[model samples]
Target: MDIQHGSGGTYRTLVDESPLSGLQWAVFVLCFLIMFLDGLDTVLIGFLAPYIGAEWKLAKGALTPVFTAGVVGLMIAGCMAGILADRVGRRPLLLAAVAVFGVANLATAYCASLEALVVLRFVTGLGLGAAMPCAVTLVSEYAPARRRAFVITSMYCGYTLGGAAVGWLTPIVAQQHGWRAMFVVGAVLPLALLPWLFWRLPESIGFLAERRRDRGAVAALLSRIVGRQVELPALPEQQKVEGNPLAIILSPAFRMRTGLLWLANGAGLLMTFTLINWLPSFLTFKHVPAQTASLSGASLQAGGAIGALLIGWLMDRFGSRKVVVGTYLGAAVASLLWIAVLDRSSAALLLMGFVAGVLVMGGQTGFQVLATSVYPVAARATGLSWMQSVGRLGGILGIQLAGMGIASDVDPISLLQALAIPALVAAVAAAFLHVTPRHVPGNAAVLKGG
Candidate 1:
């Protein structure tokens, strides 16, 4: 039986049934690279703060606003971009976002004063914030249903890998070429990839079909996916709902899951941003060498990369709920262990960083996968962006408190121990999270209610 000649099938069915194609792989790889850059650019500032501060004779926590500003940009972008992507197309928003962050970061390299850097970092953050959810939404739409979790999670590994790369790259670049040169490195690479991304990146076919424009383009993309020329069937009618997409996500049908998801995401990111933004500084405070501190801090991201892949694989095998809950709980244990062993030796510190990365980073990525699974396509971007926005807010809060604590000479070990609290909260939230059946498209009942 020729499956490509099917008389009737949903886009989901076709993709689920088909073997992974070249176009699919291309989409993944491109999105992966974008995520890689996203991680790199976002983390670059944190890693360079100590150097930047020394040059300016700034106070210990003076860069806190700069850090908070970028996260604010990210939060705002998340609040808006997802809704925008849902209305306009994903491709244009993505392009604009990349351009915005690239240019802003480039400007950051030449910043002559603290105020200028803060404003530019915020602008760059807007681009970084907008890029991630859009990329995730695109990948989810393109992915086969059965492999969606693993595919999205693996794609996200690019983010961790990018962050990890900065650990090694920052020390060398900041030492030899100067810290400004490091920003140039981060800015130039993404800008260089811009033309290629603009040329090759495909808009979501599901988005196209939902909007009922560009059927020819959709068919062309679909044909390439299935490895045969095929006619486009009428897409299954999407369930339409009234009111804002944001309101819809919080409606009765979705309220419970959405709230729990937000809690988990927020708690997870609180721990995430705290560590990523402050770990190097904390190590420096502990009398570790600047270069070694950078490397040790980076171990978090390296571990996260491994964790993302491992957790994604596990989610695909067992289920998201158990895997997520266990991962968060394990992260809590790891966080406690980090406090215990980080004072032992450099090797112990590195080992604990990796272990925490595996669980914490993996668990955080799992929340994204879970979010993508929970919302229907109509609201996926909005749901994701809002969830991310909440998480960004948590990150902002964490950074501020950590900065204040460090400035006041609070114990770094106490802060490290505090990481376990969020992990435990996330674990509790995950335990209560209910997943929609794998066979059913997300929120069919809710949408159909209208």
Candidate 2:
């Protein structure tokens, strides 16, 4: 019933043993809003690309670097935040992340040229990249074990919802106020939420309780959550977290899991993003009406949202290993189903797209839980961030490769076959990444169970 407070073990148990408090809900809600803003701002540029290109009278491909610039920024900043958050504090980094993207989105409304836009996009990506890993890590640390994965995944689902919302709003906003209006809304929401996050969001309890002896602050935080003082056990003086974040993940204890996670994440994003970026255009080539193609894309997002939630719940219930492996295999089957739906009815395409999302998108959600579980709290933020960084790189590579193949006039069917390989590779990698019940030497409790 009680966590003996000496090290990280007591804190994780304290977190796991306790139920969700009002303060914890506050953290989740705030993180979800950050993620929602992250999603909205990230997708705005993509939705506005056509208008921006038309206004500038540039080739369609000119915006490619603009997109890549953002992804590159995400890769760098995500890793940096991960490395820094444990040392710096998740709350402050999170606020700064929101500020970065929120201000960037506002500035985007007045962007003057492609060059300016590229710079702004990179800044926006920095914010987006920094916010997400911190959000997930904080939420995971806050949530109880029974629902940690589910809460974390649901927190991330805000991004997908935000992306979907932008799609719906783009047409109306672009029609009435022009492309800039989309950026305006994107900026306003995050800016509006900043005050609330600053006022309400508390630092992670695990962060405070494990980092050092701040008994008064930790006790006060417990009071906020459970409405009373939490009894503390006599504990040794805890050491401050040290070492380079990147190096921590590469240590012998974490090296294998890190490698597998990178493989799973990289290949997962490679497969997933290729399908996301290309599916609508590819469907249009099958003579599906453009509207239908758009709707089919919607189906993928909706399916992905559902898949994200479902995978999290399943992983929490059945454990990460089985669910992740199965989800990846399901994705493989779904990819094969995709090949069959070519030139088929819109209904067929939509159905298949939804299935593909449930498996592929869902699998990625499962991987997030798995990857975050391997490390001790010390390297958690860096581990998650690095995994995302690798995923972003893989996404960039995958999308670029798809673009090249399409430019070379490769058949859609062949392109899909190429995409399918990565899903299988993800499955294989996940199958190898298992979580055995293990213990850390000095964390004061069993710290390695998922």
Best model number under TM-score: 1
Worst 10 contiguous positions by lDDT, candidate 1: 441-450
lDDT of 2 by residue, 73-92 (tens): 88899889998887777889
Cα lDDT of model 1 by residue, 1-450, tens digit: 112211346566677789999989988999999999999998888899989999999988999999899999999999899999888878888888888888988888899999999899999999999999999999988998678879998999999999999998998889998899988988898899999998999998777766666878878888888888768655445333335778868877778888888999999999988888888988888887898789887898999999999988888887887888899898888777756775687888888778878988778988888888788776788999899997888899899999999999998878888888999999998887755233344533221211
lDDT of candidate 1? 0.84
Global lDDT of each candidate: 0.84, 0.75
Which candidate tops lDDT? Answer: 1
**Model 2 alpha-carbon drift over 4 Å, by segment:** 1-9, 50-60, 231-234, 238-240, 284-290, 435-450
lDDT of 2: 0.75
Off by over 4 Å in 1: 1-8, 233-243, 435-450
